[model samples]
Target chain A: MSRESVVGTAEHAAESEWGRLSSRLILVNLAILVAPVVMFLADLAITGDAGLQALITLGSLFVTFLVVSGIGLMRLFTTRYRVTEHSVELHSGLLFRSRRSIPVDRIRSVDLTANPVHRLFGLTTLSIGTGEQSTSASHRLALDGISKADAVELRRRLIEARDARRGYAVPVEDDGPISELDWSWLRYGPLSVWGVGGVLIAGASVYRTLHELKVDPLKWGFVKDLEHRFGSVPLWYGILASVVVLVVLGIAGSTATFIESWSGYRLTREEGGMFRVRRGLLVTRSVSIEQQRLRGVELVEPIPLRWARAAKLNAVASGLGSLDDNRKRRMLTPPVPRAEARRVAAEVLGTDRSLVLRTGLTRHPRAALRRRVNRALMWTVLITAVPVGLGLWLGPGLVRGGLIGGAVLLLVLVAFAVDAYRTLGHGMRGRYLLTSSGTFAHRTVALRQEGIIGWKITRTPFQRRAGLFTLGATTAAGEGVYKVHDVTDAQGIALAEQAVPRLLLPFLERDPRSAARG
Target chain B: MEDVRLRPPRHRVESRAVNWWRLQSLLFAVPLPLTFGILWASIPPTRQIFMWLTLGFLVPGLIYVLVMPPWRYRVHRWEVTDEAVYAASGWLWQQWRVVPLSRVQTVDTLRGPLQQIFKLSGVTVTTASASGAVKIKGIDHAMADDLVAHLTRFTQATPEDAT
Candidate 1:
C-alpha cells in the first residue's frame, strides 16, 4: 500500500529523529529470537537428533535474524516523524505505510524506562499510554534518545493542558518547595492473617493423625489392648489423658497468632489533605489519594484486640476497588497504637474522633454466655481424657479419676465464664451506630448516620421469638457486608436514616465548605 | 520551549479520501489473511477449504469497496475553513465529517517504500476515538505538511465550542 505522494504539509518537514529511533527495532527482534534458539538446543539434547536438529536450528536462527534485521533496517530508512503544536506525528513503513499521530491531551501517562542495554548507552525509552484503548496496551509509543528534560517538559505541558481544560488552576510549579511532611507507611508483609490460620489447621492435622494412630491412651484400641494385657481400665482414668492433648492444641492457636502478626503491616496518613499509604516487601507501593474520593471510614475492633484496645481502620473510596490494594483500591491505616488510632481516624475523616463516639456497643449477654459455655466444654473434654484413659487402661487402679474429671469440668466452666465476662466488658462507641458480635474474634464496626447508602432489616423465626432483627446498612463505598444482628428493628432503621447523610461520597465532589462543615 | 512545526491545509488529504482508503484497506485485508492461513496450514484439504472460504469473503467485500469507494483521488478534495476542516468523498453512500479544528488531536504524515517510489505519502488524522480516526493514502507528501499546520492552529484556537 504505497502512496504516490506524501500526505503531510510543508511545516511537517521539520527535523524528526524517528529514523534513528526505529533502528532499535533490530534490538527488539534480537531479544525475541533468543527464546526459540534456547528451545531448539534443549530439544536437540533431549531427543538425540543432534546433527539434523543443529542444522535446522542454525538455519532458522539465521533466517529469523536476517529477516528481522532487514525489516528493521528498512524501517529505519523509511521512518519519519514530525511534531505539530497539537499533535506528534510518526510516519513509518516499508511495503505498508503506517502513520500515527497522538494529540497532547490524549496521552494519559508518559513513562521513562531503562533496560540494561539502554542504561549502557545512557539512553531511556519513552512509553506513552493513551487511555482510549479498549484493551490496555503494554506501550503506545516507544521512542529512543528522548532526553530527560524533554520528557519532563512534555509531561508539564500535558498536565497544564489537562488542568486548564478541567477548569482547575494549575500549580505554580510542581517541584517548588511545599511543606515537608512525614508519610506513614502501610505494609502487608510476608506473614499474613492467612498464615496463622494455616498453621493452626496444620497442627490440628498432626494431632488428628497421632490420635488415630492410637498414640494416646484415650484411644479405644490402646485402652482395650492395655485391659487385655492387664485388666479393665476405669473410665475416670481414660478421661484424664484427653485433657493434656487439648492444652497442647490450645497453645498452638496462640502461637499461630503471634507468628502471623509478625509482618504484612501498613501505615497511612493524611498529608496536604491527600491520604497516602506505603506497603509491600519485594516491591514497595506508594499511593497518593486525593482526599475527596473517600466514601466512608470504618473501625474494626476484633475480640482479641479489644482487650489490648487495638483496632484496624479502613477507608472506602470510589473508583478504587477496596482497601486491600491501594493502587486500585481504597487505603487503610496501619495497625497503630490504640492511643493514636483515634487521632489518625480523626485526620482521615476530617472530624474529631470523639464527635462520633457513642456509648455501649459491645458483646451482648447471650454472646458472652455462649463464649463461656464453648470454652468450658472444650477444656473439660480435653483435660480429662489422658488421666481417665490411663485409669481405664489400668483396670481398677484409679477408680477416683471419674470424680476428678467431673471436678475439672466444673472448674473449666467457671474459668470460661470469667473470661467471657471480662471480654464482653469491651465495647464500641460511635456517633451513628455501633455493632459488636463474635465469639472467637469479635468485631465492632461503627458507622456514621449520614453515610449509609441503604438499609434493610430482617428477622428469622428464632430471631423473631428472641425479639431480635438483623440490620444491614449499605454505603456508597460498597462495604457490602454490615449486619447489626439482633438489634431492635426500629432502632436499626433509624440509625440507617441518620448515617446515610454522613456516609462518605467520593472526595472529588466534595465542596470545601461542606466538607469543612462536615 | 521546543519549536513546533506548522503545516498548511492544502497539502493534507481530504478526510473522505482517508475513509475510502480505510474501507479499501479493510476490503483488502480479508483475502490476505485467508491466503496466509491457507499457506500456513499443514493439511492440504484444510488449506483448500480455507482458500475457497477466503474467496467467498473477499468477493463481496471487494465489490462493495470498489463500487462505493470513500475516496476518488480525481474528485475528492478538502478545505480548511475558519472553524472546521471540511472533507467529503464517496461515489455512493457519500459521507463527510466536519472536523472542528479544535477537536483535531493530531496530524501525521507517512511514507512507505511504495510511496517513496511513487513519490506519494499517507496522512493519518487521529481523533480521540478509534472509530472516527481518518487515514488518507496515496496523497502528495507536500499536502501532509499543509494539513498538519491547519489542524494544529485550529486546535489551539479558543476552545469556545463547549464551555
Candidate 2:
C-alpha cells in the first residue's frame, strides 16, 4: 500500500493511524545546525574579514547547513509509526525506504526523554526497546519528537496491549507514586566517589580547554598571587589548604549535580504492570519497564555511602536494552538512608522486607580469607617494588619516601583484604539466591533462583591449591553474571546445584557410599 | 584437595590438538627472540645487551612452547548430555562451564586457520546471557558438526524463553 493511502484509510477507519512526529523537530534541527553557523558568522563580522577566504568559509558553512538540514527535513517528513494488533511498525527513509516491525510481545521497555530544547517545544523522544542483545543501530527503534501527552499515551497503550495479550491483570490507573524526591536525601550527595571524580573531571576539562585556546591559567593575576602566597607557607600547611579547597569544591560540584539530575524524581507503577521512573531538572527522562521482566534487585553500598549508612537500589531486569541504557534505567533509588533504600527495594519487588537485609548469610571458608590476604600481599609487594626500584636508581630521599608509602599501603591493603573477606557471603532465601561481596562497593544482589540460566566455575592454580573457586551464576538480567568469589570447591558446587536444581545436578557426581546409604 | 564430588567432563578433545596448540604457541613465542637477534645484529649500540636479551626471551619461550600445549591438552575436556553441555578448558587458570539444553540459543562451529591446518574445529554454545557462552575447542571437524547438530536438535525440542 502507498503511504498516503494507508494514512487515508487509517484516518477514515478511526483505528490505527500512521502517526507523524512533532513538527517542532524541524525547528530543533534548524536551531542545532544554525547555532555554530551563527557563531562563525559572528566571529567573521567581528574580525572585519570580507576577503575571498571569508567568502569561501561563508559559502562552505551555508552548504554544510543546507546538506545537514536537508537530511533532517527528509527524516522528519518520511518517518511514521503505527501500532498494529501484533507489532509496532516503523517506516522511514525517503531514498532507501526502510521498514521495521517489532512484535508487541517482545517490547520490553518504552522510554520517553526530553532535553531542554525538546521541553521548550513540549515534545519528547520515545524509544521502544525489544530486548535484543545486538548493539547494532538497526535494532534500536526510536521516534525522535512527539507531543509529551501523546508519547505517554502511546507508552501506556503499547505496554497495556502487551499485558492484555499475556493475560496479566492490567490495572486501570496508577496508584500513588511508590517513591518521590526528598530534600533531606541531599545529605548523602557529597558522600559519593562522584564528588571527588566530578571535581577532577571538571578541572581537567577546563585545563584542556584553556590549553586548546592557547591561554595559560597560571598567567592569571589571581592564580599568580595565590601561588606566591602558597610559596611562603610551609609545605605541609599548603598541602592541607589545597586538600581543604578541593574537598569544598568537590562537595559543591557533587551536590549541584545531584540536584540537577534528581530534583523531582518519582517512581510510579503505571496501569499496565510497568514501573516508570521520571526525573531530571533540565533534561527530563521517563523510563518504563515491564514488571514481568524484572528478575530481582541489587542493593549497592559504596565505601563512602556505607560509612554514612546510605545505600542505592537498582533493578535486576531483562530487556532493558544495551548495557549503557540498562545501567541508566536500572536505578530504582538514588543514595538514601539505608533503611529508606531497603523500604523502596521491598516496595519495588512487591515484598514485605528487602531480601538482602536478612541475616544469617553463609560466609565463605577461611581458605577464602587466606586467599584474599595472599592477593593483598602480592599486590603490596608488586606496587612497593616500583618505588623501591626507582629509589635505588635515584637517591636516598626516594628510598625514605618509598618505605613510608609502602608501610601505609601495606596497612591499608591488609585492612581492605580483611574487610573483603568478611563481606563475602552467599545464601538461598526462598526463591532468591543472595550473594554479597566486594570491599570497595559492597553489592548485595538478590537474584531470583529461576532467573539463573547457566553456571561458570573458575579456579586459578593458587585457588585450586587452596581448595577455593569463583562461581558465576549467569542470568539474562541486570549484569548478566553475578559471581560468588573464593568459595571452597565443594561449597561452590553445592551452591550452584541448590540455586538451580536440575540444571547442574545431572552433571555432578555423588559419593557412591553416601548414595547407597541414602 | 580436589573435590571428589565434581568429576571432570566425559570426553577429551582430539589428541592432535596438542600439535595445533604447539604450533599456535610457537607462532607466539618465535617472533620476540628473532626480532631481538635481528636488532642485535643490525644495531651497534644494542650488541652489548641484545645477546643476553635474546637468550632471556628464547629460553623461557622455548620452555613454554614445549610445556603449555601438552598441559593444555591434559586440561581441556567436554561433554554433552540430554540436559546440558559441559566444558572444561585452560591449564593454569582453569574454567568449567555448564549450560542447560533449554537455554541454548545458538550453536556455531568455528575453524581458524591453525585449526583448519589440523582439521580441528571448535563448537560455541551461546545462551541468553552475554557471559554464558561455552566453547568446546579442539574437536575433530566432523565431530564438531555432529555435536552442533545434536545440540541444535536437543535445544529445538525444549521450547522456553531461555531468559
lDDT of model 2 at residue A136? Answer: 44
Q: Choose the strongest candidate by lDDT.
A: 2
In candidate 1, how many Å is residue B144 off? 58
Compute DockQ for each candidate against the true complex: 0.01, 0.54
Clashing pairs in 2: none
| Candidate 2 residue-wise lDDT, A367-411, digit = tens | 989888888888988988888889899987888888888889989
Best by DockQ: 2
Off by over 4 Å in 2: A1-16, A33-67, A172-174, A210-238, A510-518, B1-4
**What is the per-residue lDDT of model 1 for residues B1-163, given as tens digits with 9 covering 90 to 100?**
0111111224344344545465556757666756655664756757777776667767776766655444355334445566555443333323233344444556778887646655567666654322344455666667777767767777767442110
Error of 1 at A356 (Å): 6.5
lDDT of 1 by residue, A52-107 (tens): 54565568778978987787677667766544445555666777777676664444
The count of residue-pair clashes in candidate 1 stands at 83
